[model samples]
Target: MSPLSALKISLPLAALLLPLSSTLASPPLVDPPAVPIAYSLEEFRSAVRSGGPGKDGIPAIDNPRFQSAEQADGFLDDEDIVIGIYRHGEARAYPQRILVWHEIVNDEFAGEPVSITYCPLTGTALGFERGDTELGVSGKLVNSNLVMYDRATDSEWPQILGVAIDGPLSGKGLEEFRVFWTTWGQWKARHPDTEVLTDQTGYVRNYRRDPYGSYRPLRGYYHPDSRRLFPVMTDDERYPPKSMVLGVRTADGAIAIDKDALREEEVVDVSLNGSQYTVVHDPDLDTGWVFHNPDDIEIEASNLTFNAEGVSGSGLENLEAVNAFEAMWFAWAAFYPETAVYEGGEAL
Candidate 1:
């Protein structure tokens, strides 16, 4: 771990320092599996608290522009964190530095409208199908996660829950797609033709600095043992508050796998709601891929390839891919208090 520096700022103050702006757009909705939540819609809404800047306080990228990977090399360092997605022959990278300023990016993936959201406080980045709507930061937070609102109905959708807790669309869930939390070099190496989001985001702050903390060497609020900026609905001490976990949720349940454990074991088999699943570690990308293995297929990992009966693929191919994303342990626990957690290839 790297030593703390003057760059660190009090999180409460950090929230107040965020740039504020509001957009008239709203996020779209779809009928995907509702995220399993132990709390009622009322409880989620009741827990919501002002996260410093008010609605649109943290502006979202509406008209996103991109540059080729080679052009991005001028600003991006190899270890810089980026949220990546590949779909319909289009691969794009959204740098964390830019997202740290704008929590949401209303973007289109191969003609399919989607919203890429990141919660700096919770250390989560997720992509959701928006259809014709655009999501904006509600400037409200529950469990220290970003709460989003759609312009269409003015409903509140917490980024992690992916469900509206208030407004006419309350209880509605949004369709989601997979977004990889990996480094700049890792994403570019895998998708050479990837387009990188440019810092040309209309609103500008110091894009080089992260107000929350640093992910490169892990310090400030991002430190595994750092204290949370706000109180969560539920708290679990089983893992460090900021520790990263690859989490998956269904309409019935939720589960999380410790990233460190997945890295060590390479492959970890687990069960969710009576269905078998497997999490495979991709060393090259330094991320995990979760697959719904209903038949309990026996999987073997040799180097970067995973082999199973009637399945053979390098990294994340030839499997029923599940939409999962990396989240901070505290945030995951807060929303899904009953989530089963696994570490070291064993349930903990």
Candidate 2:
């Protein structure tokens, strides 16, 4: 079946096309006092052409169940990947095994409503504050990233961008939280008291196997040399499509620091648009974090540690955190085509 036609099999015929086309084409000339759509029909169609199982083909875990780290030891292996979040003195780990299927987890953390999302296709894991709203999979893929929708406004939010592209809340961006993509063993080593998401989800599925492939075994779509499953808006040959990077963006522009290069350098200082920022890699956890250098602190090559509290070492204290996330090179380049790439700590 054609990509467009295949979408109809799982989505309501009207829901699959009409709303998206109308929202993208143009808002009524009359002032409805609502936020105007942020993108054009061509842009919307370019990103959201095909549809998966309508809304919630893969159900989100709303009332998530968790177990102690020690209790989760049996199912999760040491090298299994997970997204770790620590806030307000609370810590939680969302395993990739679970996220690969649900895509989104609407839950509360540290008494605040947050959405933990992962798109296996693009290798992007993000956390966002929902405020009074909740997020779910819209069954749409834009630039090979998951498209999310809010329960309150029903606006579509492409996960990587974190902004509402359609519906009443268009142009609104969700508040993001820091979520680290790391191995289960590394996370447990740092946050021993962390609560791990359990597999007792209401929906029944094969939790033992992943649809995309295994990261530990490095098989299927996740293999280093595997090609992207879907077409992206743009393709840049500067980096491999599946190459991982610590991506950061500002009003001026976006920058992607090669994760592998960061690991080699351990600490790389970057300057973008006259603002200095430091990208530090934690060798132990195999994760990277970016912090704005308001004081122009000179970071040296050393063993670094980054947490919600910020990076370690002198002169780097109290640095404001820059919103950043780990993403595949292709997805980052697709959304920010003009982005500058940081290769071996130098802009290339």
lDDT for every model?
0.83, 0.77
lDDT tens readout by residue for model 2, 1-348: 223445557557756655554443221122221212334535955578455677777688888999999998998998999998888888899999988889889888767788899989889999888766678888888888899887665788788877666887666566777898999998998888999999998778888889888887788888766798788878887777777888888654688988768878887788777778887777667777678886777777554555545468765667776777888888888888878788783786
Q: Point out where model 1 deviates above 4 Å.
A: 1-32, 303-319
Q: Which window of 10 residues has the lowest lDDT sum in candidate 2? A: 26-35
Worst 10 residues of 1 by lDDT: 303-312
Q: Give per-residue CA lDDT, model 1, range 1-348, as digits (tens).
A: 011321486787656644332333445555553568688888887899999987787888999999999999999999999999887778899999999999899999778889999999998999988866688898999999999987666788899999889998888888888888999998888888899999998775899999888988999999999999998999998888999999988764789888888889988988877877888888877778778887776677774452211124653355687778899999999989999998875665
Question: For model 1, what is the C-alpha lDDT against the true structure?
Answer: 0.83
User: Each prediction's TM-score against the native?
Assistant: 0.88, 0.85
Best by TM-score: 1
Q: Which candidate is the best by lDDT?
A: 1
Superpose all Cα atoms of candidate 1 onto the true structure and report the RMSD in Å to 1 decimal: 8.3
So what's the TM-score on candidate 2?
Answer: 0.85
